[model samples]
Target: MELAQRVQSLTPSSTLAITAKAKALKAEGHDVIGLGAGEPDFNTPNHIIEAAKRSMDEGLTKYTPSGGIPALKSAIIDKMQKDQNLTYNQDQVIVTTGAKHALFTLFQVLLNKKDEVIVPAPYWVSYPEQIKLAEGNPIVVQTKEEQQFKLTPEQLEQSITERTKAVIINSPSNPTGMMYSKEELQAIGEICLKHDILIVSDEIYEKLIYTEEKHISIAQLSDSLFNQTIIINGVSKSHSMTGWRIGYALGQAKIIKAMTNLASHSTSNPTSISQYGALAAYNGSDQDIEEMRSAFSDRLEKLYSWIVDIPGIHCEKPKGAFYLFPNVKQAAALCGYDQVDDWVTALLDEEKVALVPGSGFGSPENVRLSYATSLDQLEEAANRIKHFIEKHKG
Candidate 1:
């Protein structure tokens, strides 16, 4: 069967593959410790769940505007004004199925054939593929762990070309869990403004920071920067509402309207009840979020300490998000594998532990492990990993 050339060329997400494999092993009665998922281990807050129930009772399960209901949009606007010091009218925001969908729609609306989007190395797995789906070329700028895996202004300036259309910035980054400071964001935002390139700020992990390092949206740096930036965020990560499929984008009304029109024809209207649930998440107390962040912080510290003790494994302490991306280049060689992916496969097979190799995240020397699980499970997983390394170390 002939498939679309675009679909044929797409790379499957390594995170999902390993997670599925882990599940398969677990189903076969193996005690698999899967660490490949990127979601919080917490359940949705009670208030949010109650909101969804209320929506259903009120017959709000029907279709809504493709861009989202006004109540949710208002809640999002309030959040941006309070949290980000950025204000936007309703016309400037469009709600989509998830932050991923918001980005996919934006890329479709913003890019032309062969247009380039500057993606930093160790990026979220979906960015490059989404750009490719939109027929845009991804210009990957590599960042080092020593520098906290952040793209420098000079690197951003170097990656831009006449065909460059936009740059995607993920604070509290997915694979690395490192965030850009306000000054760093300002510098990068300035370069994008100077180049007249759009900035796509993915702030889905905004509330997951674990250090003194705060999450700053590149769009919030300055008025000029805000004008040229599109902010993508949702309650998925912050409120543990990943399954609800409610995310949104905020930007210039023109771009947002185009994205909304695209959404209209495609995924016309995100789930109605989910939008209500997200509104509750935004308006309710952030206690649940803070609690989850605290748990993740503790797990990160313990996991980092354990990782450092493992021979041939090194990683900078991740300041945010729930994952630890450790450089295991030497570990792979010790395990007699040339590629980290093969080493990951061997570890999963031998130890029943799942990890997403960094090759898919554009860093072949490392692997990502999510700490979004119970502390006991994490400790056991750490022990298993250490034993695996000890057994394989040459």
Candidate 2:
């Protein structure tokens, strides 16, 4: 049997692969503790679920417009204006299956063969793969943990070439859980503007910030930048609606139209009931979000302190998102392991703990642990991780 070259060239999602391995072990009666899954353990909020139920009851189960239903599009536009202080018309917004789909559509519509995309190191696992699938080259800019794994303006400027078509900025970053400040964003935005480069801002974790720092969209900095930026966001992380598969993008009408056309040929439209659920998520009270954010913040603090106490394990306090990326190279060395991937695999095999190696995210010395589970599970996982490190160290 043979597969298409394009399909054969693609790599599977490492995060999902780790989760599947954990599930397979559990099915065989192993007591696996999985901290690799990205989605929150919390159920979708009641109002959002109720809206989906009502939509199904009202027989609104058919296909919607390719982009999205009119009501959901309007709701998304309003939410952007109110929450992010960015305004867009209905035609400028297109809801997709999720932020992942929005990003794929954006890349498919905008990228060409030999085009270059600036992807900061320690990036989300999907960014580089998605670029490759579009036949675009991924130009990686490395960042250090001491710098909180964020790309500086100088690094951004240095990476741009004549072939550079776009740069991806994932605030509340996927693996690092770090965010860029408004000033940082402005600096990078200026560089992109000067080079006439497009900005792909992934702000899916916009509402997940845990510090005094606010998440600022690069598009909001200037009108010119706004025209050049495509903002991708969704209800998956914010409203615990990952299964709902509803997300959106806001950008210039021309670009949005292109993405919608691409989506029309592919997914056609997002799920009808899920679109209604996302509409309610945007129009509904944000009180539920505030509560979830607070709980995650609390859990993050506890987890950070616990991991820091483990000798030779280094982790920066993440300001947003539900992940902690710790550099465990020293522990790996003590365990006679040569790579973080091997250490992670051994830990899962020996201690029934599952985590993602940093190698998958363009780093080779760290591991990503998601704290989206309950506090009790987090505590137990941390203890098991500590014991594993200590046992290996000795």
Candidate 3:
């Protein structure tokens, strides 16, 4: 069978590949410690579980509206108003299968052939692929580690062309966990506004912040920015409901309506049960959120300390998200490997610690490790990594 050309160029996700390898090792009875996962380790809160169960008991298993149930949309709008002080009508919101699907649907509806989306390097792995899948080009602009892996206004300005259609801003960013400040967003937003470029802001990890800095959306900076930005978010990370598969987009009514039409032909609608689960997630007490954040905060603190103390490894303490991205070039060099990817493989084989190499995230000198596991497991993973480096010391 002939494969489609679009998928032929698609690289399998290194994060998922490493995670599967780790699981295979464990099944073979190896004491593998996998840190490549992107989701929280916690179970869905009991209340949320009960809510979904109640809906099932009531036989709410039928299909919902293509976008989402009206009640869920209302709950999402209320959340935006309460949390971000932004108001949106149901017309501007379309609930999808997940935040990832929201992004995919958005690019499909927005981009034209040869259109360009300016993506910052050290980006989430799917951003470029999603853009490409939609027949758009991903213009990756490399961000400096010194700048906390953030794209500067100057960078954004220089990357623009007549073909430039949009730019992505993933705050409390995946892999790096660095966020753009309000001042930074103001400057970048100005450039996008000047060029009539759209903004795609992925704020999935907003609730897991460990810093005093509050999560600020680029849309919140101004009315113009709000009009220009499409916000993608979900309850996966915030409510520990990764399996529930509910996420949404908030933007122009016209675009959201297009997305809704597209979704109707694709999945018909998000699973009815998961929509109810997500509706409950949003409407219930945020005490579940607070408790989960506290646990992640402790894990981040302990794991960050242990990771940085190891020789030849340098990492910036991330303010949000559950992953630590450390530059392992020096460590790889010290371990006698010429490539970071090889170093990662050797660590897994020899020390039984699985990590996601940063090559997949467009930053080859680094590797990402999730601290979403138990403290004891994280501590052991750290110890194993330290031992791997020590044993291979040049």
Candidate 4:
């Protein structure tokens, strides 16, 4: 059997790959401590679960509009207005299977063969692969650990060429947990505007921020940029509804329409019951989200301290999200591994601690550890990782 060239060229998500390997080990009675998966360990809030139950009991388990149900769309609009101070009509929003789907849909609609997208180094594992699957070239811009792993305006400007179509900005980024300030976003927005390039702002972790720094929507900076920016958000990270598979994109009417059309031909609408659950999520009190964020922040701080104590490992204090991307080149060298990927594989095999290698995200000497688990699990994982390094040291 033969597959299409596009499908054959694509790579599977490394994050999920690591997770599956960890799960398989656990099934064989190994005590695997997985820090590779991105989703939180918490159960979905009770109110959201009740909303889904009510939808099922009311027989609302049917198909919705391809672009999403009107009620959910309206709720999303309201939430965006209140949270990001950005206004959008129902026509400008389209809910999909998840933020991943929303991003793929946007890329499918907007990208042409050979068009370019600028992705910062240590990006989410899916961004480059998704862009490649869309037949778009991914131009990577390297950002240093000293810079907090954030792309500067100059970096963004330098990466733009005649074939550039869009630039992806992931705040509270996947592997790094780095976020951009309003001023930083404004500067990059100006550069995109100068080149007439689109901004794909992935803000799925907007509600997961720590520190006193606030998340800023690039679309809210200016009317001009608003028309050129597509905001991707979901209930998975914020509401602990990963299994619900509810996410939405907000952008210009034409872009939204294109994405909706693509979705219509593909998955049609997201699950109707899940849409209702998402509606409840947006309309419900944000107090639940605040509590979760506070808990994650506490766990993240504890994990950060533990990681820095490990010899040959250096980590930055992330201001948002629940993951830490630590530069472990020294650790890999001490362990006599030539690559971070090899080190990660050995750690999972020898220590039963699962983590994603940075090579999958455009960096070859780092590793990403997600602190989405309980504080106790995080502490144990850190200790195991430390022991693994010390035991293998040259």
> Clash number for every model?
0, 0, 0, 0
**Best-performing candidate as measured by lDDT:** 3
Summarize candidate 4's per-residue lDDT along 225-326 as a digit string, tens digits: 999899999999999999999999999999999999899899978999999999899889988899999999999889999999999999988888889999
Candidate 3 total steric clashes: 0
lDDT of 2 by residue, 1-394 (tens): 9987767888788898999999999999999999998898889999999999999999999989999999989988888788778889989999999999999999999999989999999999999989988999999998999989999999998998999999999999998999999899999999999999999999999899999988899988999998999999999999999998998999989999999999999998999999999989988999999999999999999999988888778998899999999999998888888888999999999999999989889998999999988888888888988888889887
Candidate 4: residue 240 Cα off by (Å): 0.2
The collision pairs in model 2 are none
Using TM-score as the yardstick, the better of models 2 and 3 is: 3
Off by over 4 Å in 1: none
What clash pairs does model 3 have?
A: none
Give the residue spans of candidate 4 off by over 4 A: none
Let me know the TM-score candidate 3 reaches against the reference structure.
0.99
Question: Over the stretch 123-222, how does candidate 3's per-residue lDDT look in tens digits?
Answer: 9999999999999999999987899999999999999999999999999999998988999999999999999999999999999899899999999999
lDDT of 1 by residue, 178-234 (tens): 888888988888888888999998999999988886678887778899899999999
* Predicted model with the maximum TM-score: 3
lDDT of each: 0.92, 0.92, 0.95, 0.92
Candidate 3: residue 83 Cα off by (Å): 0.5
Residue pairs clashing, model 1? none
lDDT of 1: 0.92
